[model samples]
Target: MSAETNKALVRRFFEEVLNGRNLEVIDELVATDYQEHDPFPGQREGREGLKDRMTMLIEGLAPTFTIDDLIAEGDRVVIRWTNNATHSGTFLGIPPTGRSCRFAGIDIFRMDDDRLAEHWHVVDQLSMLQQLELLPSS
Candidate 1:
């Protein structure tokens, strides 16, 4: 696929899959053997694991996610995103605080055969925790 197509696929992931809360699209957009370099706690492996992780996130945060930027080059797409949501469900052993939080992250995805094959991401967890009042801000 062309670089533009790859970028579009990534966009659809954030728009239709994440923000839209449509998990069905994962099977079509992700490879069967997808890999996540930064797996969440208790997160399994492969595309199924990816689906599980997303499910947990959606249920826990009920986030309104937004993609701030997207860049694609040679079968890779990088996305900068922000999410705003209330902590209504447990996440990473932290019980619900019912507080609103905003966090940003950057993800790099590798495309294989027109599907997402691998992913690596960095999220502002510390800031999120602080926003939740789980940690003191500096």
Candidate 2:
């Protein structure tokens, strides 16, 4: 697929799957044997693992991401995003605090045969945790 097409696929993942709460679309967008380089602790494996992780964020934090940028080179698409969310449900074993948080993240995804094959992510988790009262603010 072209770089534009690869970017579109990743955009759909953010819009439909994450914001729209449509987990089923993961089957279409991500490879069945997907690899997440920064898997959260206790995260499962493959597509299901990705789905489970998304579920936690969507359901727990009720997040909505604003894509700051999408840059594609070859089969890789990189996304820079900011998320605004509320702690509405248990997340990472912490019960709901009903606090609101904002965080930024960058992710790189590799496409293979038009499916998302692998991913690497970096997020400002410390800020988010502090906002959620899980960590002391500096």
Candidate 3:
């Protein structure tokens, strides 16, 4: 596929699959043997695994987590965004704080055969916890 086509495929993958809360898009956009190098551990393999993860995230952080400044380059897309969410639910051993916080990060994606084959992410994890008052600021 052309680079442009690959870029479009990735866009659809995110919008229809992740943000749209549609797991069927995975079958359309991702290959059967899709692999993801997630920074967070315990995420299962294959598209079903990804769907489960997304469901957990959305349910846990309703109306809070969002993706912005999303852009694509060739087969790779760079996304810069902020997550402004209230700590009303458990996350990474942190209890609810009832405080909303904002943390920003960037992620780079590489597609394989027009499917989301791999991902590398860098997020402000420490900053997020600090903002949520779950950790002391460094």
Candidate 4:
């Protein structure tokens, strides 16, 4: 796929899968042998692992996730995103605080045959923990 096509696929992932809470699209957009370099706690490897992580996220925080920026080169696409949500369900052993939280992250995706094959992310976990009152504020 072309660079533009790769970027579009990533955009669709954030829009349809993440923001829309539509797990069904995963099979269509992700490669069967998908891998996550920054796997969530307890998450396994492969496309199923990605689904598990997404399910946890959708259940824990009712977020309005947005992509702030996107860039594509070769078979890779990078996305800068923000998520605003209320802690409505347990997450990684942290019970819901009923608090509003906002966090930012950047994710890089590698495309294989026009499908997402690998992912890596750098997220503001400390800021999110602070917002959830799980850690001391700086």
TM-score of candidate 3 against the unseen true structure: 0.73
Looking at model 1, the pairs that clash are none
Q: Write the per-residue lDDT of candidate 1 for residues 1-138, one digit (tens) a residue.
A: 988999999999988888899999999999999999988898889999999889888888888888899999998999999999889998767789999999999999999999999999999999999999999998
For the record, the alpha-carbon RMSD of candidate 1 to the native fold, in angstroms, is 0.8
**What TM-score against the true fold does each predicted structure earn?**
0.97, 0.97, 0.73, 0.96
lDDT per residue for candidate 4 within 1-138, as digits (tens), equals 888898899999999988899999999999989989977899878989999899888888877788899999988999999999888998776789999899999999999987999999998999998998889998
Better of 1 and 3 by lDDT: 1
lDDT string for model 2 (1-138, tens) is 999999999999999998999999999999999999988777899999999899888879999999999999999999999999999998888899999999999999999999999999999999999998899998
Model 4 ranges with Cα > 4 A deviation = none
lDDT of 3 by residue, 40-135 (tens): 355677766666666655544432435676677667777766767666665544556777778877867777776776667787878877887778
The TM-score obtained by model 2 is 0.97
